[model samples]
Target: MTRVLLIGALLAAVFWVFSIVDCALQPPIRHRGVSKPVWIIIVVVFPVVGGILWFAVGRARASALAARRAPDDDPEFLDRLGSTSDQDERIRRLEEELALLDAEDDDPRWRRPVPPPAASQSTAPGDPADKPADRPGDGDDDARDQRGAAGA
Candidate 1:
């Protein structure tokens, strides 16, 4: 008999804890008669009785829970969304932009041209013509050669 009483008390305590957690976790709108905090207080203060009351009276009905909807899923909210014409206009603008891009791809003027080097610029460093000693009118040896050519 004492063991039976202890087991019953243990079950009640577990039920009380479960009820308090359930009540506290519930959203305010899901509470039936009173606010969520009040429900939590009721469950906390009365322990086993509070937990039973919370499950029986305070919790929202299954139908009410089932009736809740997210904003995107709600019919009234979807109806308030802008008309198809606005979406069509935006799509048309996007198509126009894509057409412009396609036209640019086919147009010669839109192509980037690789420019030829200017005549005044020297060749790359490894070339004999690019060496300072080989270049005309550059250093003392070139000036001497020019004077010798003039004298000849």
Candidate 2:
């Protein structure tokens, strides 16, 4: 009898620790009843009772296998199960599009759009509009240009 009581006390302590850890790990949004902090306090203060309450009221229910309702309660899961026909239609449409693209590829004359030839105004090596010939000694030209602009 004394051994059984000791084992029971040990089990209760283990259960209390497990419940407290699980409750602490659960995010506030996932907690159902009171709040995560309150649940933790409850579990710490009362071991067996708090663990039972946590399982009963504090844990969040999974959408796929939540506690009680009719089979049709989850319409999204039902829709997923019923999507074979929609998937077949989608695959057919994609195959048709691929065939059209392959036909276009087979014809050498049906080529992708080409950009128009670049204008010749810029003689610089890189992109003409982006970089200019200005360098270390270019400040003289800029000062002259600014002076000219101010005068104008």
Candidate 3:
């Protein structure tokens, strides 16, 4: 009976230590409008009862609060799921069907010949006008031009 009592005491001490450390690491529970520090004091001052109370009530409340604050779903996770190859295949098939339906509709702009670049432009002849402008002084021209304009 004495040995059993000693073992029980040792087990209780271990449980108390575990509970205290776990509670300290976690954000404190707010129970019935009482703050976490009060709960921590109660647990530390009255180990067995405090530890049991924390496990039963405090931890649950804190967990619930954290869950409520957490974001609903991960954007990257949803993106990966939504953009899977199966979805891409479905989109491709729909686009092909649309193309077939629109084949009879002639839009001249889609088949029009591209205009040639101006002679003064040193860019490749086939390049579009919207392509980046080629300039001899691309690196320092803007600053020099600004200073020149200011001086004038």
Candidate 4:
């Protein structure tokens, strides 16, 4: 008998703790009869009875859960979105800016062609552009002259 009573008391204590934690942790919007703090106080003050009351009265109803909807489905949420024409105008402006940028990248005026060196311009002997063929009496030319003479 004493063991039964002890077990009952232990169960009641666990229930009271669970109720208090549940009430405290619940969002203010989920509380029904009173505010969250009040629910927690009720559970703390009344123990088993307070826990039962918190579960029965303070908690929000299951049907109320249906009020929540995805932002895309909610009328208030959809109302906040502006007209499609306004979005289209923004998109059109963005596309025009992108086209303008691409045009700038491709424009010949933006990138001038590097002109080839004039035929009249003199090059130094050590210049990288001064090839052996460009110089008179080069070894290759002498060799070609020898070969031509031998062939003749």
Candidate 5:
């Protein structure tokens, strides 16, 4: 009995407070029976019944609901005429990109990075490139030689 009474009292207080806040935040015309100031007075005067009525009877229509919702949830905006071609174009572009990515995956340039040099193949003494080549011996010296020959 005590618990029930306490719960009911808490609920009444919450509803009263939320009603006051909601009434204050809402636009004037949205209140069904009275203006914003009157609604605030009513909610404070008759907390439970007034709060319940505020939600039940004073609720806004779908269009008015849009004023409070995110743009995505705005019914009018979502229902507005749109071109299917735009979606199709986006999908086509994405598919083309994905196909290119697939082709890249097959190409060696995009292949999984060469595995790190095998543990057994120690780095050559004083090699400038740290842990070059996925495996040992694939090193800076060979690359430098090729460049040097090209330069000559």
Candidate 6:
């Protein structure tokens, strides 16, 4: 009886140490009602009863709650979701097309011809009529020439 009690006491001490260490190391498993420190204190103080209570009620419940809340950790589920390679391939194709268009547009031979200056347009900046009209799409062919003259 004495030996049995001593062994049980030793086992309880070992279990208590393990429970405390586990509680310290693991991120506190959150649940709806009870907080983590309360559970830790219960486990640490009560030893065998606390450890049993924690494993049976608190720990199991917390783990089940976490599993239900977040299922993305499952590798099989992720595998079934399909790869992003197709998206990458589509983006690459678009980038290649853009590059081709840029190369074609940048080539001097494919460039649009610059329009010749209008006959009535004066290149002088000081001319009252040469002041740029605010109206949109007004034929102001000499604007660039006047700016160039002013800069020089």
RMSD (Å) of each candidate, 1 decimal: 13.4, 15.6, 13.4, 12.1, 17.3, 11.0
lDDT of 6 by residue, 1-152 (tens): 99999999999999988877765655665422356787788888899888877666666444365354244877777778657997788889999999998877777788898899878865677876775654433344333544223323
- Show where candidate 5 strays beyond 4 Å: 62-152
- Candidate 5's error at 64, in angstroms? 5.1
Clashing pairs in model 2, backbone N/Cα/C closer than 3 A: none
Each prediction's number of clashing residue pairs: 0, 0, 0, 0, 1, 0
Tens-digit per-residue lDDT, 1-152, candidate 5: 99999999999999899999998988776777667888888889999998988888775655755356776787777777366887799889999999997777666776678777767645678866555543324643344555223323
lDDT of each: 0.82, 0.78, 0.70, 0.82, 0.76, 0.69
By lDDT, the better pick of 1 and 5 is: 1
Model 3, position 78, has a per-residue lDDT of 63
State model 6's lDDT: 0.69
lDDT of 4 by residue, 1-152 (tens): 99999999999999999998888888788899878888888899999999999989899876776688899999998889988998999999999999999877877788879998878758788885566543335434344555323323
User: Which run of 10 residues does model 1 get worst, by summed lDDT?
Assistant: 143-152
TM per prediction: 0.44, 0.42, 0.40, 0.46, 0.40, 0.43
Please give the lDDT score at residue 120 for candidate 1. Answer: 88
Give residue 139's lDDT in candidate 1 (0 to 100): 44
Give the range where candidate 4 is weakest over 10 consecutive residues by summed lDDT.
143-152
TM-score of 6: 0.43
lDDT of 3 by residue, 98-142 (tens): 999788567776776879885784666666654443443333234
Q: Which portions of model 6 show Cα errors greater than 4 Å?
A: 29-33, 60-143, 147-151
- Weakest lDDT window of 10 consecutive positions for candidate 6: 143-152
Overall local distance difference test of candidate 1: 0.82
The numbered model that scores best in TM-score is 4
TM-score of decoy 3: 0.40
For model 2, the superposed segments whose C-alpha errors exceed 4 Å read 64-152
Candidate 5 colliding pairs: 117-134
